[model samples]
Target: MIKFFRKIRQKLLSENKFSKYLIYAIGEIILVMIGILLALQVNNWNEYRKQGQKEIVNLKAIKNDLQHDLNTEFIPGISYYSKKNKDLSRLRDFYLNKEIIPRDSLLKYFRNNWGEWHIILNKGAFENLKSTGIDIISNDSLRTKISSLYSNGYPEIENRVNIVKQFYDNEFGPILYDNIILYDSTHSHDDFDDLKNRKQIGNRIIQHYYLRTWLFERSELVKSKVELLIGDIDKEIERLDK
Candidate 1:
């Protein structure tokens, strides 16, 4: 094609058709420019397609992470914290009313009441997205939501959990260790009866109640955020599928 165009230009120049040659030269330049533009457009289209596929994969990964969290962390966490909160509330009521519960009951309530929340979010895809470029997500709203969930929502939940855990460890743990036979798994009725008579036990029960209440509230908040994130992920996934 280049040779053919070159021969035509040479003939035009030799025939002294300078005006025609100029026009032909200009046309050739326009064609070359059009070709370059088309090539660039095709390259851009290919890159867009690749990014779209990558976005789908990332969205799916995020969805899976959220699903895993809902099943393993959020749902179970909500149930566990809810039940524990109720138990602690009942125990607090007993302490306030000066009512004596069975030793096994008290032991049961205290044993499973406290738990550490260590939420492990699957942030690999998110991190990659952030590092590579947020534009890869395509959808502005979805990208914003993803960013908010990872940056603000997750960190808030983590901070809340850490605060509660620190309070338990630093403030409440030592009191139980010092005053109660915490290590005695096989606690007798006498041990519980003795704990009831201790004046400081009421304060400890109150502290436990407060902690459990905080935990329950935090668990609910985390669950809500997780649900919202899941919804956004589903929407993004659907969009990507199209």
Candidate 2:
């Protein structure tokens, strides 16, 4: 193509067709400019198409991750309820009925560990979303559903956390430590209820037992919220498929 253009220029100059040559040169320049512009436009279109595909894949992965977390962590996490109930039953049998102190410790490690772990799915997932900025151009329905899911779900989770926090601060913390102390000390199964009736022991037991009950209920509430979030993701995935 360059050779062709050069030959044309040489002929034009040799023939001394100055005005005609100027018009031809201008036309060639315009054609070249248009071709370059078209190539650039196609390149941009290809890049955008690739980005769109990536966004869809990322969204699907995020949806799956949320679903797995709901099933694995949220529900089983609340299984502490059944565990705690069993412990309580054993305690009742030993102290109230058998009048024998069991040697094993009876505490739900789940609720205790729950207070230690800081869980906010939004943090990591939202970071991924923000990094991609794909949600900016997502389908309107998908965007709306995502927004509603986070909004509706996060607040409930936060409320549950707050309730649990209050339980921990007012009831669980001191009582658990006191219970540990009693466990280590000379207190026996015979002193179970009466120990609570004592000025020092009674206050701690009342708080501990009350918080234990509340902890189980709060676990259920969190589980419900997580289930809702899973449903929200399912709806969004349906939208994506469409």
Candidate 3:
């Protein structure tokens, strides 16, 4: 092609037709520019396609993390706390009414009532997205929601769980350890509720119960948000597939 264009240029110049040669030279320049533009366009298209595939992979990774969380952490944790909260409520009510229940029942509640709420979120995919660039997600609304869930939602729930755990460990745990005569989960221990700080213990149990209740609700909230995000990611992946 280069040789062909050079031959044409030489012929045009040899013919002494300066005007025609000028026109030919201009046309050749235009052709070269067009070829450069087309090559650039193709390169850009390939890059775009590569980024699109990467986005889909990231989305799938995030979805997997969310699913694993629901299966292993969120669902089980929520159920555990839910049931534990109920037990705490009953124990609280029993304490309040000063009703003397069975020794085993009282000992059991005293032994296991102080529950801890802890949350650990899977942030691998999210961190990868952040390193690349959040805008890589493509969908404006989906990107925003993803960012909110990772940056704000997960952290907020984690912080709340920590606070609840701290309340249990620092306040309720000490009281039970000091006052309860013999508290054991597996072994049968002598149960006598004749503790010196009965009133203080009851109040602490009540306070811890409320905090655990709130923690349960917070865990449920985060789980629901994660479910919705998983659904959104599925929809986005479907759209991308086409």
- The candidate maximizing lDDT is 3
Best by TM-score: 3
Candidate 3 lDDT tens digits, 59-141: 99999999998898899889888877777777788778855556567766765575564767799989988998888899999
Please list the C-alpha lDDT of all candidates, in the order they appear: 0.75, 0.58, 0.82
RMSD, every candidate, angstroms: 3.3, 7.3, 3.3
**lDDT of model 2 at residue 207?**
44
lDDT of 2: 0.58
Per-residue alpha-carbon lDDT of candidate 2 for residues 36-72, written as tens digits (9 for 90 to 100): 9999999998987776667667666666766765666
> Judged by lDDT relative to the true structure, which candidate is superior, 1 or 3?
3
Residue pairs clashing in model 3 are none
Model 1 regions lying over 4 Å from their true place: 98-104, 114-117, 170-193
Candidate 1 lDDT over residue span 173-214, tens digit each: 666667665456656767766767776767766876786666
Name the regions of candidate 3 deviating beyond 4 angstroms.
17-20, 98-104, 112-117, 181-197
